[model samples]
Target: MRTCYTGEVNTQHLGQTVTLFGWVHRRRDHGGVIFIDLRDRAGLAQIVVNPENAEVFATAERIRNEFCLRVTGVVQARPEGTANSDLASGAVEIVCQELEILNASVTPPFQLDDDNLSETTRLTHRVLDLRRPQMQNNLMLRYRVAMEVRKYLDSMGFIDIETPMLTKSTPEGARDYLVPSRVNPGEFFALPQSPQLFKQMLMVAGFDRYYQITKCFRDEDLRADRQPEFTQIDCEMSFMDEFQIRDIFENMVRHVFSTVQKVELPQPFPVMSWTEAMQRFGSDKPDMRVKLEFTDVADLMREVSFKVFSGPANDPSCRVVALRVPAGGEMPRSEIDAYTKFVGIYGAKGLAYIKVNDVTNIPEGLQSPIVKNIDNDALRAVMERTGAQNGDLIFFGADKTQVVNDAIGALRIKIGHSEHGRKHGLVEAGWKPLWVVDFPMFEYDEETKRYYAAHHPFTSPKDGHEDFLETDPAKVQAKAYDMVLNGWEMGGGSVRIHRADVQSKVFSALNINAEEAREKFGFLLDALQYGAPPHGGIAFGLDRMITMMAGADSIRDVIAFPKTQRAQCLLTHAPSGVDEKQLKELHIRLRPQEAKPA
Candidate 1:
């Protein structure tokens, strides 16, 4: 319908007559001359309408923001001092000789130029919202990233294969979004949380390398980084171990950053074990940008007369940890008290601290009521262990290990941003990638009083840990590895248990009885029996990767039709009521409501 996009009319195209189609981004009037910024997905081009072309000028004068227009114009350089340095087509303007107002629009609910529009209002008029330059750039960046990923994988002999969206429900990580089966009557098919099973099955089917940019659905609570449905760059490979898979994906990620974002990532990403990451940073996915780390003070506090520290230290399930904040000694008492209350959300009992006012004189420098009970030597020992310096503040947590880790880990990131005069910036230039390996095969579910697979049941236990599968599930580490960028878990995969015997052993450890396993995953076990090769693969959350690459605050910013916090799509008004006839066909009935007297 058009010869060129509005954004393509640049200084290079000056004096060339071209046809362009787009919505009127903005219209301006200076005396008798009318100017309009015409916008399409490519970007914007300034269109000038002079009285010399009376008919075209009249059409341009009537056009409002969002008016769909088609124009034939000669691209010309903007007059001196009129060039827009901020735009790609800054040096040029389209002098319209002809104009066609294809469609007129009312003033939009919210201005496209307004940055402070509420998300709800913006979503309500999403068509207009998407016309914004930033939103356009984000979507364009997303497309480039996806394309780069596909190209990299395809070059490495990975087949672009697809998996079923409607499959049998199995407990993967999240709750499945089920579709009621009309043919089967009362049965349901679930949208995949991931292509975890089918991708593994492709390995069994002898497709050594497979990849899919697939949509996954989960009926779970929404977060800034999550949605009811999301896309994943799902890939799996056979005859490869954890290290081999990690290396391939890491390069692919680097390729994506370089090609799409024009940023060259580090050559080799630093690797850290699950145990080390957790112990030092209190989180498996540690934001290396923050310099803060948690130091164990359990041993030092165990012998202390103070019960607050001593009690948790004595308990095997509990821990005592501390965070040393640089130049944080001057933090107000109210601020410290507020932080204590903040940790309460993570079930932390309270936050304790020792503010070091000065390092030259150890006794006088330390400020804490607890320091009075402990001698100077003990206080000095605590300071030395935490690597505390003058003008540093040490915050402590004593509780169950989970509480301590959750509270302190989150606080580190929060404080890294909130604390002024702190060295708060990206951990390193470009990308800092890592493969976190050696995750536990199973974590003991205290509530269920049973072991649950840490990653998934199909993941193979590390070599020599096979014997511990039944003996001590907790001691068995999976050959799983996660690719982490900064702090986000970009993707994860593990070497699968190709042997049915080993897979069965894993199932047993996860408290999945033979009958239940057969019911849920019999196809997988049956497939494994027929020559399944040693394979592993990773699936990157496409939204998250794109969001991070674009430096967006949340994954929602990158998604076109994102859901609200409650997982409702405001644009589509989804999760709405169904017609009675439609419900009847599905053999469903709405529950009756109580009658109210009028």
Candidate 2:
């Protein structure tokens, strides 16, 4: 219906008659001269409908925001000082010779440029919301990223293969979203949490290489970075060790960034072990941009009179970490108390700190309640260990190892991104991608009194760590690597246990006996016995990747249709009721809610 996009018209096309089709982004009439900004996916172009052309002027007068139009005009240079330097077609304007309103629109619920609209309103009217330029650009960037991934993987001999959506319900990390089968009464097929098993099967089947842009479902608590259903760039390869797999995928990500974002990520991203990352930054996927780290003060505090520091310092399963916040001595008492309250969220009993007022004066200049309890030598040692300067604030987390790491680690990030940190130049700019490897094979659940796979059961133990699988599960490390960008885990992968015996040992370590293992992962175990090749792969969270690239605060912003935090789709109104007959056919019955006592 149109010869060119509205945004494509330029000064080079001056005097050229062109046809355009788009929705009216804005309409303005000044001194009887009508102007309409026509917007298409390409962008916007200004149309000038002079009153001298009465017929076209009359049509322009009727146009309003979002009115779909078909226009034929002569592109000409804009009148002096009337050009829009901000736009691609700003140098020229279209002199409307003919105008046709293909469709008219009622006033929209909210303006496209209104940034403060409620999320519910935006989601409910998603079609209109997506018409906004920022949303359009985000989706376009997503399309380009997907294309780049395909191009890179295709060149690397990876086959674009697909796995099943509905498979067996194998309970693991997160609860699965199940689908009831009407034909097989009482039987349910769960949506895949990932193509973890199927991809491994492909290696066993000798596919050699595989890749798929696929959707995965996990019925878990929602967060900014999470969704019930999300897309991943899934991949797998045969005969490659963990290092080889990391090299290939790392290059692919660099390729993606260079091609799509025009940004060159650092060559050979830094690699840190899981233990080092937790101890140093308190997070496996540490944001290297944050210029803060934990310093050990356990040895110095072991003999201190204050039990708050002495107890955890002497305990084997506990730690005493001192985090020095530069220029933090100036922080108010209220802010310090607020930080103490913040750490409590992570099971921290309390937050301890010493404001380094002056290094010259030991007990008198130092400001902290615990200062008097510790001897001058111990206090001086704590200061020396942390390199606490005259203007630094040394925050302490002395508790169970996990609690200390979680509390201090979270505090590090929060402080680094806070206004005070920015004022002190704590957060650095640009991309910081790294590989967080050497994750423990299993994590013991104190409540469940059982061990769960840190990555997954299929992941192979690190070299020479397999022997510890059944004996000391905590000592075993998986050959796992995660691609962390800034602070988000963009992707993760690990070498698989190709040998049947090795797989059985891992299952046994997790307390999954032969019978239970057979019931849950029989297919995977059965496939492993049939000569499965040594293989590994990574799955990039596509939503998370784009969220970082586009600088969107949440993955939901990049997604076309996203659910609320409660996981409800405002637009579709899903999770609705069904007829009793349909439920009977599926052999399902609704359960009434249990009433609470008055």
Candidate 3:
């Protein structure tokens, strides 16, 4: 129990005797006066002890970083020039009349202010790591965001409702984390990847509007922005179409940003279709802050003698995209090679380029090893199409449509933000919120020769495209929309299929036959048949949102207990072996491992 937080003490509280409790952030000594920085989640406060109080001074001098303590001190103004101008409590110090060491700490494995600590070490000592001020602030910001989201939705007549975490698993793209059933032999319940099905069912049940800040689990590979278990601001509504849903959530998002981050986001974010985004930026969730963009050159290169560009250009399914970097000709060849290697990771065969130095002479103007292979006419056409000015470097990506989009899109962001782009005046410094809509209902996997839902099966196909579902699934667009902040996809949703026939058609388009559909989603189909209302909803990655709001690089830093990239909890040593008896109860058995020789 404490009367005042460290960062709250000020001139107004001078001469006031108050009780404080916190860990000693740091300890210092100047001659006979002992100083300790007491820290709480509120922030740090300076506590000074003088030889006048010999016992308190002795106790303060013994304190070290992370030593938990309780203190009774008289607040007083700091000596002139000794004030910390950067701190809220800089004007005053707590003169400790009493000091009680509640708990002593062993030296931390790493200091609180230490930079570049390995993720493993930080995670292993997460409790101490969480005590760091930045971590405290991030988690607090996360809490504030959740509260504001709930408030905004609540004001909009959205009821806070919960869906079951343990439910039957039907494929929703990613693998689900399953819970073995003890009562039912050879059965399992899955942690929801999202409340997608349940939220839609709620609309069918006529809840009108429902929202939940729920946990979602996926047994998938990890990344900087992902966790095996994550949170979503899940929502759904009945009798609402795409525009209404988008408007409501957009305002909610703006409300969240304004209230929590003190940043006012623009109303009605910019919109682009899935096709346009892919063609120009190579990503549905494109970062508009970066100035680099792709221009189509497939047609111009189709008749060229160079097979590298001509081969893909001639194929209708492939694409050829060029990115013009302003004043990029000055870049050294080594940097260009490094970028070529970077694009190769995205299945690019190679990055082709022509450096524009002097446009006056067509042949002598360009400088690149590939310049000889590119016909002068084709080169001139590309230069004209891309508006390649002098001192610009035009990088080309030629491959399957998706491959070119992925590689060139990624290259755009990398080059636009890289040192060269900044030097060339290409990188812009601002945030741009956008909406990427009209996603295709199905994306055909050329490898598997099967069509998968671009968003999810429940997402309704756009009107009149119902015919395209049977005739041409590739051309079927969905009434889906995604909210993107700068580059990350903050949230996405679509109008749901409230009709049984339509839902069944979506299932069939995804290669799910009637019998299998009944086995997997019978309840949903049956519900649709019985008075399901037209509805739609969105799910925002709460961790990802908070990560951006807190300016944290990884979602892991904002999470209190995050698993490793390999999905192992370093602190708890999770995913440890289960005893044979427990497995027997769940009617499961594992194959025996071969004996190892000692």
Provide the overall lDDT of each model, using Cα atoms, as 2-decimal numbers: 0.85, 0.91, 0.89
Work out how many backbone clashes candidate 2 has: 0
Global fold similarity of model 2 (TM-score):
0.97
What TM-score, computed on C-alpha atoms, does each candidate reach? 0.96, 0.97, 0.98
> Candidate 1 or 3, higher lDDT?
3
lDDT tens digits, residue span 328-443, model 1: 87688888888888999899888888899876576788888777766666677788898888888999989989999999988887787674425534133446677788998888
lDDT of 3 by residue, 477-510 (tens): 9999999987899999999888777877888899
Runs in model 2 lying further than 4 Å from the true structure: 594-598
* Candidate 2 lDDT, 419-463, residue by residue in tens: 889999999989999999999989989899999998888889998
Residue 266 in model 2: shift from native, Å? 0.8
Return the top candidate by lDDT: 2
Clash pairs, candidate 1, are none
The positional error of residue 433 in candidate 3, measured at the CA in angstroms, is 0.7
